[model samples]
Target: MKSLVLLFATTLLLLSGLKSQESSNISLIPQPVSVARGTGFYQLKDPLIISAPPQNDSVKFVANFLSNRLVNTKGGWVSTEFSESAGKAPIRLQLLPKEDNEIGKEGYHLSVSEENGVLITANTSTGLFYGVQTLLQLLPTAAAGHTVVEGVQWQIPAVTIKDYPRFKWRGMLMDVARHFFTKEQVKQFIDNMATFKFNMLHLHLSDDQAWRVEIKRLPRLTEVGAWRAERTGRWGEFTKPSPDEPKTYGGFYTHDDIKELVKYAAERNVTILPEIDVPGHSLAAIAAYPNLTCTPGTYQVSSGERIMVWDKGTFYALQDNNLCPINERVYSFLDTVFTEIAELFPFQYIHMGGDECYKGFWEKNKQVQAFMKKQGLKDANELQSYFVKRVEKIIQSKGKRLMGWDEILHGGLPPDATVMSWQGMKGGIEAAKQGHQVVMSPNSYAYLDLYQGDPIAEPPTYSMVRLSKAYEFDPMPPGVDSSLILGGQCNLWAERLHTMRHAEYMLWPRALAISESIWSQPAAKNWNSFISKVEHQFNRFDAASINYSRSMYDPIFKAGKDSNDSLQITLSTEIEGLDIFYSFDEMFPDQFYPKYTTPLSVPKGAANLRVVTYRNGKPVGKQIKMPVIELKKRAGIKVKETP
Candidate 1:
């Protein structure tokens, strides 16, 4: 009881002191480039204003926002000098490029100085628009009661700012094959990537569930794999039939659709990397061309129940699984498939599915063993390595690089091959140590298919990894050279994710948190600070009508109450401006604006205290799981007998 009293007192003191210091401790510096607590705000002081004459409405509008942020102080001015003759101007502002002007074509760039005014330019309207976003970040945050318009506030600061990204390959990966997303949805994703300054999107187009891209040479590849009659069972158990099966599900992109998406992504400076699995996740291939298998037998559209050792569809027969008798027909089939891939995707790197190839087939086949002896291959695992090497040569000969799951590293990876680390950092670490580039997408952090929260609330998957864990990830493990870390990706493999809503449910707000991890510097990261940003971002998602998991906010924000008398809660979601309302008596909550403080109070004798999140006078999105709280205090005081 005595210890409990002391602990309560300590917590109360700490929270009180933090609250007192909150305002004064806020840095007076221009924009805080660190993790945004709630919303990232910028304030301007003096000698920074946009005074340039108006060109297009977009240019002028963007300039106005920048001027407001850089001149956020009580009195300051920023002028944009827009003219054909930018003579003797300290800063020159231009609009969408005319064939001759080169300032804004690629994206937005803002050059600022304490002595001179700020100049901003972009090649397109959107570029200038993004420059404004950067300028706002460079300014100062608004004080209490400042009005916000369209998610931006005018709190400008005076200073010189020069900023840009360090690497050109900042990227993320999305798998639409497990569950197909429409072209429009893909474009929406491109827009989302643009908001965070991410520059690449690796699309895992082909998987065992479905094949997405259209290959003209092999029409059935798309006809059979691109669309499935009905999806298989859940991730772990593939016994029961899918209850909500679509009679005919799946779709593929036409050549024109691909071209449009390519142009769209290029406009946003995002390169699309596509993956086509081979050798093993080849049930899709066999279904399309039964002749590709060693047995040359009939194959069905995979029900997610693949034969581990041998099947009529796979190269190794059920009983005669071995590499001894090298199959001439299988090689020819693979050659044609690779040739088609080389023609379809212009990306330098191509993913060949090299994971989960069961060795049981080879162990049983005497012909395979005989061929292995003939070729002097040591063991079955070594044979898999040889298989990968052969494919690597095929991809390399056509001027492309081969990328595979870290499983490819099992037998022995070719020097030229790259690996996507999914199991853990071990594959990436080994690959980098051997002078090969690696993309870290470890499942502990990057697997988005796993429930972002408790399975009781959100149905379960094979993994229990959460969203906050994803945000806390550091791509390069300690002691590993960062040079070998090419980039990172959050993989959304669809096993339970059957529909587009399920896809969005698994991705959103979580992917938003990950965007900062990949783009922002390490020192700028803070779990608490990010939650504040998400509060407002949640409103943004609502405004966009994106259907995401409601339970995801718990761990990311740590919103539950402690056993102490008061609610010692932490707002972990990145949304800003959330009004937290709570009630100990369970009647309803007393509203608190921007409720990111600790140890909230509930009415006396309150049995339960629950909080609801709101934005802008309305419930922003789904209500979170209320944390269990108690109102008991210490029992240390003793009464005299006379009393």
Candidate 2:
């Protein structure tokens, strides 16, 4: 009896000692694992070893092969998939296929164990794809330009992780309808999506401004509407017309182009959701087929005012025009257009932009009023609902679901439709409670066209959406049913943006923050930490020669590092990659001052400090000055005036 007691106690002591050793090894790992694991996931380090049969199925092989190929060897693998001996590696992964699971219905099952091999079973290829993405997070962060090469140096960090996205439809919307982006540009956007693990790209293909995709049945639509006159001016400069009035504008994607884009996106695991704006933002379509309008007329060809064009004789001089009321010809036109679009995009959802259908035209037309009465509609809003329902039925026949802006809920929403909550969170909550899926893209946070920082620092565009507000956007609103939330997207309205560089300036640095918000657990959100990651990404962008705006250094306060000499402090803080020097006293005539040794010292009790920066012994930019004390510290800690 005593011997048995001693044996049991010894076994307990052995178990405890083993656990302690495991804890110490794991302590060497990062805190992110603690957070990820607490959420019930087995987080594995990058360059993970997935043990499989000597020869596995293509899907499993592909999953592991991709991780092995893409995992950043130099940066440390946060996510990876490779085949090798497990006992010697930090993570031992095993891929197991479920026998009873139906094809295309597989999902990831991930967990960690004390056993040598970790089993990860999936029922479909898609499950494996998602698992690869989760593996990416477990890998370490690399400095910009560092590629995950085969062998150099690899670290086996202790981590067990399991993760899956809450929303399956996380997305981003790119409006090619407003101004066409080249096929290469579209693919570039897809590449960016892959970097952030974004799974969907909602392509807004048609709008009032132009028609981007090609329909073999309608050649003239693209040949004409796609190319407008000169582009609009900078943001807010929309009102200004260029002197080069006669210049033409536009481009479109051929059927071949679209097929290629879809294939490209598919390879990156991104589903492209194409949007066709209906009823209201249909001036371009109306122009293509004037007979569809209640007021059929020719468009006065001109530059700069594509947003507002009228039936030549109806509303003369004032410029703005409305979508002519629904007529038989209009429905027929949409039927033909959608028939072709449905064939091209096989996705379950089709975006029928049901927003901002002004009432002026409906009120003005007697025919519309009579049609409304016959259709049992009360007012223009109800008529709009009827229009959406009809389109929804047509789309349903094609085996597709209808998605529209929040305005579709006005008067009445289609029962079979999903709502994109752009106006605010309330619409999403309302839609979800009513048993519909919602994509929350509130303009205040998701509108990328909004400037990223202070107006003075950025270009003279419209006001900017500060970085913090974007970071705070929660796709899943509190009290909102989780099942109803489809996902969210960031919209970059290009009304004022023209060149690709301008597009990059508006997208980058900022989009990085949005990506982290949507993909990373929300609790891990920190603007400062996000800024650091963004800076690292900027280095990658720079090394790739991708055009992007440089992050500005924070201005030094008069009481901070610049306290010695206000003028020198100001210059040092203001300039980037330059040295500053100045002199306050009249002493040392013809004296040479070292960089950062400027003599223009701030006076004691001075309210501001001044500084100038120089490169190669010459002043290239203007001097700057800042206040001595900050008004608020809770707002954010200021970046060091010196970088």
Candidate 3:
């Protein structure tokens, strides 16, 4: 409470006014390229006028959006109207007058002056939309909340900001195949990503779990493949569904829904990249048409039971999910699927997921072996690559390019394929060196589904990617061809994300770092400055009822064994200037508790530890309690005893 209030106070002081036209500390996510703040302010009051050019529907849409936001602000409705012209309008949104502009095509120049009120200009409407986004962030902090508050004033600080994205393909992946998100939910995602100038939304539309896009000719694709039995616990541990069990869960988007979502995203300048995972992760499709796989039989859509088990760092598939590599029918099925997919999505690149394919089934099948020998395919990897290459031709036949996970670089790399690197920077680097266009989404840096904080303090996921790592991500590797590297994205695999609230919690804060990494110049980034901006964004999220993680403030505990084999503990934080206080006896620790200054050995007879974090003598993080045994487990030690 004290920390937020202090942050608010600091924000007020900074936003109130500035001197010498310096870059003031106005916290905007995906920090603008350049900003010069001027003294004084522009007070926005009732009957605010927004002027846009007549017959320019795009400008009108942006203007109306700003008007609505002002009217719906926390303090109450601020009456606003639109007109073709208004003398010195309170707000004006439009494109630049000339073909040659002051900023990039997707860039905008926002000026808030006392004389002219607020004017945002760009080379395109998309740029103007981004400018309005910055303009909204400039409003008084008091107006940041979904609920109404009386006696609040809307004051716009005087500043000029020239902003442009650092890369063209600023994107994020949402795997709705595992857990279907409604059309409205997907639109909400578009709105959130668009706020930070994310241009692409990779919709993972199908996987082993379920298929999430409707095809007109293949009715069973949705009838039998789109749903599964409800699973209540963690992923990969749910009990197997009975053969007759009713598939009461899951959903897919109709053609109309897809069109509506595409329109909604385009209005906000976001493109939808629909993915239909193939060759592998195709249980849903095989469930609909058993003949798609090497072994044809009745197969149910995954109900969260373990399909592949990991042992000794390698996965072993329990069922045959990979599509038949040499089967001609498989290509026909994919051709039909991609034909409708190409018609529905105006975006050029259709993502064909070709990752984590289990090839034992193909290697064992006698017909597959014979076909492989006939084609001169050396191994099962080559066969899978052959399948993707065949699918690539189908995609290109529909006048679309092929994009897939980094695994598509197996036995053969498609000449025109765009690789989305998820394994790590290695695959991305490999592809970039080969002159392929790449989007670096390595799980090590950008997997939003991974735990951002200590596993004990966060929701369940097998892996972790810290916020610092996300901020430190550089889409362009040190030795790669920078031109072939088309920015990057963070992915939120929905296996464990059951609701939009949880998804938002995992995506934001971390996604903000990704946005800055992809949209802001690398030299312009500072960790401390970025954290300050993120803290400020929390209020805006609250105003709009958006969920986010405060995990960065939580103390990260590390346990290690001393020379004597006793447990030694250390505490640190993602954000600087936080003080960690601890108690060994398990009583709730507060600011008065002993502050952590150095590594502390386990105290005699202590059963557990309690800790909390504070800054400026006010609690900023949730109090955490850790049992002594948990500490030993954290240290990867067995047969632990209290030191």
lDDT of 1: 0.61
Q: Provide TM-scores for the models.
A: 0.67, 0.69, 0.94
Error of 3 at 133 (Å): 0.6
In terms of lDDT, the poorest run of 10 residues in model 2 is 26-35
For this target, which candidate reaches the highest lDDT against the unseen true structure? 3
The per-model lDDT (C-alpha) reads 0.61, 0.61, 0.87
Candidate 1 weakest ten by summed lDDT: 28-37
- Model 1, range 135-213, lDDT digits (tens) per residue? 5333433321123333443343333333344334556677777677889988977866665666678887776666778
Q: Write one digit per residue (lDDT tens) for candidate 3, span 228-317.
A: 999977999999899899998999999999999999999998999999998889999999999998986779999889999878768879
In candidate 2, what are the lDDT values of residues 1-643, reduced to their tens digit? 9999999999999978875554433221101212223222234445555444334454545455444544533434434334543344434344453442422332355444433334444555555555544444333333223364443333222335433444566687887776778999999888767656677899988766787888778776777657655555553234433444442677888888888988888766788998988776666665566665566566522334534434632332232234444666666666777788888876788898887666666776788888888878898888878788888988887788999999889778899799999877878888898899899988878888776543434555444565567777779888877878877778877776677778887877566656666655666566655654555556557645567654234223322233332233323342245565433342221115544543344455555433345556666433443343331121243534535
RMSD per prediction, one decimal?
A: 12.1, 10.6, 4.9
| Count of clashing residue pairs in every prediction | 60, 36, 2
